[model samples]
Target: MKNYLIALLAVVTFGLASCGGGDDKAADNQEATQAVEQKADEAQQQTQEADNQANDNANQEENQEAANDQAAAGGKDGKTLFMENGCVACHKETEKSVGPSLKEITAKYGEDKAKLIEFMKGNAEAIVDPAQFATMKPNLEITKKMNDADLGALADYIMSIK
Candidate 1:
């Protein structure tokens, strides 16, 4: 009977020790979970801030484009006014058309700003694509009938075709 009691006591002691060790492991797991959650939260916050900055930059770019368009409509540069008024309708960029293409025109003038502006003022003959000049001749009559300010704007736009 004494041997039986000793064996029972040993079993109970071992069980208690095992339970104590398991408690410490549970605490460690809880702490590790808390750390992971905290790091995830920080990452989420950083991502949100980056997204907000991108949105702000996009908005600023859009605003800038709008401002440039408005300036193109009213600038004293003349070419900007012509582009704003849709003078590109009859003119093409490289090939021939109802109006001479800008590429050929620029090729003939070779970037002479003063001469181009003067030519746009209806003073000079068409340099590169005279074949289309006849078609545009009636347009000159119509443009001449326009107000001086409007005509200047159109001429400026013509000079900018390049």
Candidate 2:
């Protein structure tokens, strides 16, 4: 009877020790999982930062290109002035929109750049589409504010369209 009791006690003690060891292993596994998650989060943050940096670089390149184009145009290119002055909203190269097409204006002017400049300066009447003069009247106010050089550039760009 004594021997049997000793053997049972030994078995119980061994089982308890094994259970304690399992809890430690479980804790170690949980710590490893948390570490992996932390590493993954760090990697994701780095990737996001890289994407932001790439976007910033692209924006800088675009700004540089725009500056270079402006310089190439001698401070103000005719086409740039035209686009900036809202001419593109109405006068496309070939197709008409709210007003006459640039091609139509070019055909009417026929290298008469001075007349075109005069008209933009509001010194001359609308020869291409006199019917829509009222629609363009408000825009003339904007052009009337520009200097002769800018007006000439705008007229040159309009006349150059095929």
Point to the candidate with the largest lDDT: 2
lDDT (Cα, tens digit) per residue for candidate 2, span 33-83: 999999999999999999999987896576556546656767785788878
**TM-score of each prediction:** 0.43, 0.54
Q: Report the poorest 10 consecutive residues by lDDT, candidate 1.
A: 152-161
* lDDT of residue 4 for candidate 1: 98
For candidate 1, what is the TM-score?
0.43
RMSD of 2: 14.6
Q: Where does candidate 1 stray beyond 4 Å?
A: 75-162
Model 2 pairs in collision: none
What is candidate 2's local distance difference test score?
0.84
* Model 2: ten consecutive residues of lowest lDDT: 62-71
Global CA lDDT of candidate 1, please?
A: 0.65
Instruction: Give the per-residue lDDT of model 1 (tens digit) for 65-105.
Output: 64455467664434544455455677776766766677666
In the order shown, the candidates' Cα RMSDs to the true structure are 14.1, 14.6
Clashes of each: 2, 0
Distance from true position, residue 126, model 1, in Å? 59
